[model samples]
Target: MKNILIFGAGSIGNHMTYASIKLGHKVYITDKNFAALERMKKKIYPKRYGKWNKNINQISNSNLNKLNIFFDLIIIGTPPKTHIELLNKCKKMFKYDKILIEKPLCSYLENYNKLENEKNLFCGYNHSVSQSFQKFLYLIEKEKKQKKIFISIKWQESFKGILGAHFWLKDEYDTYLGDISKGGGAIHEHSHGLHLAIYILKKLKIKNFDFNSNIFFKDMENKPTYDVASVLRFSNSKINLVLETDLLEDNPQKKIIFFNSKTKIIWHNSFTKNLDCIDYQNKKFKKKYNFKKNRSSEFEKEIYHILNIKNQNQYNNSPLNIKYSIEVMKKISRTLKNAKHF
Candidate 1:
C-alpha cells in the first residue's frame, strides 16, 4: 500500500481520506483542528470504513510535533490561502514525488505562479477521471465530421446546499464559500465546467479562441460580490463554448450540451456524475451510464490511477497536472476581469 498523507480535515479532505482508505492505502491525516479530526475519526471507524481501519491514523498538531515522515503521496487538501505555505512546509520535511492539491489551486491567479514545487504536483480535477466523461471523450475523439462544436454548462444549487454541505466549518458559517476575493462564489467555485471545456479543447488540439464572461450577484448580505449568475464564453474555429454557473436555481441542474449543424450531444451533471447522454442526429439516440457507487468510485479510480503511476517524472507532465489547472485559473482571472456585471 502506498503511503498517503493528507493535510486537511475539511469536507474534501474527509472525502479524500475515505477514498484513499478504500483503495487500501496507508493514510495519515493531519489537521490543525482537533475537533474536526476527532469528528472524522469517529465517523470513519465503524464497519463503514472497512477493514482498513488499522491503516488510517490521525495526527494532532502540537508545538513540538513535526511531520518528518516520508510518504509515497502527499495531498494538500487545505484552504486555497494555506496551500503554498503548506507546500513549503511539506517540502522541508519530505522528499515526496507525487502531491495532489485541491481545486482552485490557490486564492488568486497570481499566487499560482509562486508555487516553486511543481515537480510531481497534480491538481484535483476528479471529473476528468470519471468513467462517464471518459466515455464521452471516446465518442468525441472518434468524430471527424463535426466542423463546429458548442459546449454549454448550467450549474445551479441553493446557498444552504453549497455553504452548509461543502464550506460550513464545524461551528462557523461562510468560511470561504461566501467570499469572492478568497476564490469562492460561482465563477471560481463552479469552475469545473470551465476546466472541463479547456481539457476537451486541449485534448482535441484546437487552440485559437475568443472568450467573454459576466458575473452577477443578487440580494446577498455581508457579501461584497454577486452570486446570481456568472457566464463564460470561449469560441474558436472548431468550437464555441458557453458555460453558466450560479447559486440561484431551485432545481439544481448541471449539464453540458455539444452542438454542430446536424448533431447534438448532451451530457447531464457537469459536477456530480454523468448519468445521461442524448445524441441527436438523423434520429435521436439516448444512453444512460450508471455508477453503482457514483462519486466515490470516480474518486477511487482517480486516486488508484495516480497511485499506480510507475514514473513520477513522466506522470508530472500529464494533462491533468497543475499546469493545466494554472491555465484554467488564468483564464478564469481574465474572464472575471473582462466580465459584464448585471
Candidate 2:
C-alpha cells in the first residue's frame, strides 16, 4: 500500500481521501480548518473500505507534531491560490516521489515556475486521465491518419459552484459561477474540453493551430470573466467551442462533434452515465462508452496511474502538455479582454 498525504479537507480533498482509501492506499489528511477536519474524520470512518479502516489518519494543524513522516505520494487539493505555498512546504518536509495537484496548477505562471526543477510532479488535469476522453482520443487519432478533421463543442450547465453544483447535488446554488477571479469563469469551468482537444491534436502531431474565445459576464468584483465561444484553426482542421454556462441553461448538455471529409461523429452527454456517440456518413452508426460512474473513483484511478501502482497506456510529455494548457489560458485571457462588449 502506498502512503499518501492530502493537504486539504475541502470538497475535492474529501473526494481524494475517499478515493485513495478505496484503492487500498493509506491516506493522511491535513487541513488548517479544525472543524472541517473533524467533520471529514467522521465522514471518512463510515466510508472506509474493509481492512482499509486502519490505514486512515487525520493530522491537525499543530507545529509540535513531528515532521518525520515519509509518504510515497502527496496530493494537493487545496485552492489554486495556496498551491505554491503548499508545494514549498512539502519540498521542505518530505522528499515525495510523486505529487498530484489540481488544475490551473497555479493562479499565476510565475508560481508554477518555482517547481520547474522538481521531477515527478503531476498536475491533476483530470480530463487527461478520463477513460471516456482517452477513448475519444484513440478514435480521433485513428481517424486523423485518413483525412482532414474539424471539431466543435457546445457545452452548457447551470448553477456553477465548485464541486457543489454537480448533478449529484439536489439543490441549486450560484456561489462560484459569477466570481471571475475565483471561479475563473466559463473558460476554466470548460477548460478540460480544450485541454483534451489539445492533447488529441498534439498526439496526432498536428501543429499550426489558432484558438480564441469570446467572453460575457463578470462577478461583483468586476473581474472581467466570461461565458465564451472559442474557435480553433489548424492547417487541416477547424474547431468551434461554445460555452453557455451558469446564467443561461437550466439543464446542461455537453456535445462534441467531429467532422471530416467522409464522416461526422457526435458525442453528447445529458444526465447520463455513458456518453453517446453517433457517426453520420452514407449511413448512421451509433456507439456509447461507459465513462466510469463515480468521479471520486475515477480520480483515484488517475492517482494510482500517476503513482505507477496501476499501468496506463500513457504517452506524451506532461510538462509540454501543461504548457499547451497555459497557452490556451493566455489566449482565453486575451480573448476575454478583446470581447468586452459581449
What is the per-residue lDDT of model 1 for residues 1-342, given as tens digits with 9 covering 90 to 100? Answer: 778898987777777888887788888888889887776666533323443355678888773146666688889888776777887787777767688887877765347875544667777877777666666766666553578777777766657566555533541134766666666667666767777878877776777888887777554566456455678888777787888888777667776777666656666653344343434343455555543345557678778767767785657645557777887778767766675321
Q: Report how far residue 226 has shifted in candidate 2, in Å.
A: 6.8
Full-model lDDT for every candidate:
0.69, 0.59
What's the alpha carbon RMSD for model 2?
4.7
Clashes of each: 2, 0
Question: For model 2, what is the alpha-carbon lDDT of residue 179?
Answer: 41
lDDT of 2 by residue, 1-342 (tens): 988998887667877887887788888888887886775565543453222355568788784146477788898887665776787788888757777777656553233544545556666777566655556666766776654566766555545433332333343223333344553455655665556566666777777755554455543353444453344333444433333333344456666677777666665543364333443342355555545346666677677667763222232355223465455455555555666632
Q: Any runs in candidate 1 off by more than 4 Å, and if so which? A: 43-54, 63-65, 115-117, 164-173, 218-226, 270-288, 312-317, 339-342
What TM-score against the true fold does each predicted structure earn? 0.86, 0.78
